[model samples]
Target: MISYIESFKKVSESRLNDHLIFWAKTERKGKSKTEIKEQGLNIYNVSDVESLIDTALERGELLVLDITEADRTFSLSDDGKLSLAIFLTDNFCDAYKAYSIEVDAFTEETKQLPLSKMTIMKYFYRGHSINMLKENLALANSSNTISIAYHHHLISNFYGITSLEKDACTFHFAPRLYVPPEWIGRKVTIEIEGLDEPVKLVVTSPYPNKRYYVAGVKLGRLNTANGFYPVIKPRDSFPAHKELLLRWKLDDEIRIDHHLKLNFKFTNSQGRFFSSEQQLLPDVAGMKKFTLTTTIDHSTLSERNARVIVHDIFNHYEIHEDATLVNFPMELHHSVKATSYFSKWYKSWTAEKELI
Candidate 1:
């Protein structure tokens, strides 16, 4: 007799019904109809997947059926349940090997068994020694074509911007670890902290989410988010009553030479906050430096550290947390055209005077 395990591979969910039907029909041509019916297997061509599911529910012997999301027949319960396996279809074929896993089944009698689990896998085994026939004829309950790597994931830390049309831009951002199976080929909406409109970004690729996974989204232009970038590292030490140097940049194209308000926050290891605000008229570009006297009395010889977050006065069109477009390509600004606006130098603030 042909081994059930070998027959199982030969008759997967796709051709399971056809193989059973053929077995019944071929035997009927030789034997009488009553003799063929004695095997106690009924074969029928159902109208849809739901009807096929109904056939399974009515008769527990009904084994396999292929289906999509359009419909469902019976919902599973405690007494009877279904194991939903999601897999990328191409991974299974005759030439390639299909993965097999053995799991314990839970039932009234086996409730106290050591390895008992709720999931139910019904099967029969017959063999001896190492060469045993293991038949695992199961239903193709679900299939996901997109292959996602579950083990490989990383929290990404980057944002993106792409130029679109006149006065309009597309901002790309991803929140933390973005799984490709859930993100790719879909449009999602997210609310940024400062931007007015609910931003929408399409996930273009999958990542670690870091191999440029970007977890980053793309937002179209409406009201841009507010931006606050620290230009220079604040002076970490206080020389009794000496100067405290701090600097910042804004992301607004508005050429305001008027003073704007800034609130600076500082926190020590215990998360206690010390805050102060200053008003200064920035240059044509929103950039400014401040040197103030502080009597907060800390050592100049020893080291002290504080966390910092700076907030600017409200600008309705502020581009939050991004300033790259403020220094746009020079060609866009020049009447005719100019060279690309590249960064003059790497940031060397608080470095040696010569480097500055």
Candidate 2:
């Protein structure tokens, strides 16, 4: 029997050598093209040739090729050679070698374990490993199917339960189940059947008096319908403060009502002295457009220095000063774009400086 390590090593070495040869051929052809260009003294560019050479050298170092003639039978198309050269130059060969080594180690470690345990471990390992490979390789979705199948196999083989459904996308493992005692909840173990490996699921019940249900299991593209399952934790509370702004455009005359109310409170570091809620009505009517402004008053820092945050929901912030305390008004205005269906009906505010 071929040892796991030896099998993996053979595959990795073969791939590496094939990549190296492909790169070498591409580099040679590219150099010949450059030579012809140089001899003809034409304006033919060799930048692409130089880039190919660089790629070949990078990939060549990672490949381990045999010096013997029989092992040098690998062949690739011209375009394929160039692409392989680029892949090798980008250190993809090293990444694959690393992955192969990891896989070998994992296989060796799990060799003595029960087949069920080994399958689960390999499923998890391959899932994470393939995810890492995807970050560097733009693999097609179809390529992921193999890994999903492997995971499903592990689950089915380990559990003895035969009723498991494969997802349409072929990237998930789902197992369904139904149990009795609809009023008393209990922990349950789910096993997926039909794999060469072991797969099990452990679920805890949230309600002690109610019977638990297992609705479904979903992993990636794999979804299984088991039944309703108990949830251990409940949801949380809502936020106390949330500010939202809506913009509206006016095509014709309209009446404003008290229903248009802005309810909010503001406080400083000291306490809540400026806590006030009020409804705002349209002060201007029969106009082309106007903006509604809501200002939250903080507190007076000094006689001439009062801090107030003014916002109109859609537009930016504008800090204003009290003219009674200062001789001049110092206003800092910041504007934000309003994303509303009525934005076209509103007029843009004039850019100016005011003291507040």
Candidate 3:
């Protein structure tokens, strides 16, 4: 029996060696320094010619027929040609090595779904890895593919009932997708047989970055038993000490009368919580957007957490909470774009930076 690990190794070696053979088979006959540089910078996504050549040489003597020092050219040996031929044949006959991940999801109450699996059969040439697999897959199918899959996986692991008081559960992943601000407050449904109907969820916030993305999801309780609901949608970051605008919405079922009070609880990194209260008096509640201007005294820090609560809703409290990091000093403007000088240098030398 062929060992999968050994087979993978064989495949990787063959793939790398084929790069060298490609130069030999070209019309120019052998690989020149310029050709080698191009292959290193473009094909392999590396700039160090010495390291690239060293890696090719590690495949063994058979891959290189001759290295002409005078002209700085390379040609594949007979054995290398044979290896390249086998590699080509294998690629045609067998599937290329693919990467996949077994993702698990759950509701804030408990884990409800079995592990969901996704695979990437097509290997991405740059930054070849499992992260690349997911990134490329998302790109190919459109980001919506990942958004749906992420929700499905999260819903599958949910168990039992949950109250609005529960905090939004977060799932961290390397989605490599730019989640727009408009995606916030979007509703998603998950169907399970035992439930009365599909369970609805809303995208409260999504903190996406090159390393990982934090997805904030919570049960979309459009209709509450007490008729008191609040969903706070705050920006990921804002300016420090300045008047920050905190936006939240009241569900249609909520009655914004004199008896109801909306509470905003802000907590800084020091674990201190500040409170703000407002008695809403809307004409009638059919989903209303409210903005409250507030400032955190924590000038030393830039991140905080928030929770919104509806109090005295006929003696019941309905709440929506999220612990996603809300950064301050809006001047920093942290985002997913690769803007560092090193990133630019790397892109100019090789390919684009793999933000996974």
Give per-residue CA lDDT, model 1, range 1-356, as digits (tens): 01221222122343444455565456566665577558533343433323444554564523322233542212232222222211111223231121112222221132311111111111211111111211111111011100001000100111322222233221111221122243233332222333323334322223222211111232232111111111212224311121112111122221111111223332112111111111111111131211111111122101112222223442211211201112111111111001111111112212433465
TM-score of each: 0.21, 0.16, 0.17
- The reply for model 2, stretches above 4 Å from the true place, is 1-22, 30-139, 161-356
Q: lDDT per residue, candidate 2, 4-92, as tens digits?
A: 21112222333444444454455555456667456432222334433433464455422222234333212232443445334433433
Q: Give the TM-score of candidate 2.
A: 0.16
Order of models, best TM-score first: 1, 3, 2
lDDT-better candidate, 1 vs 2: 2
Give the TM-score (vs. native) of candidate 1.
0.21
Alpha-carbon lDDT, every model: 0.23, 0.28, 0.28
Q: Model 3 off-target regions past 4 Å? A: 1-35, 38-157, 161-200, 209-356
Instruction: Report the C-alpha lDDT of model 3 over 102-200, residue by residue, as the tens digit.
Output: 212111122211211111122322234645544543354353333233223333434332321122322111111122233334332211122123333
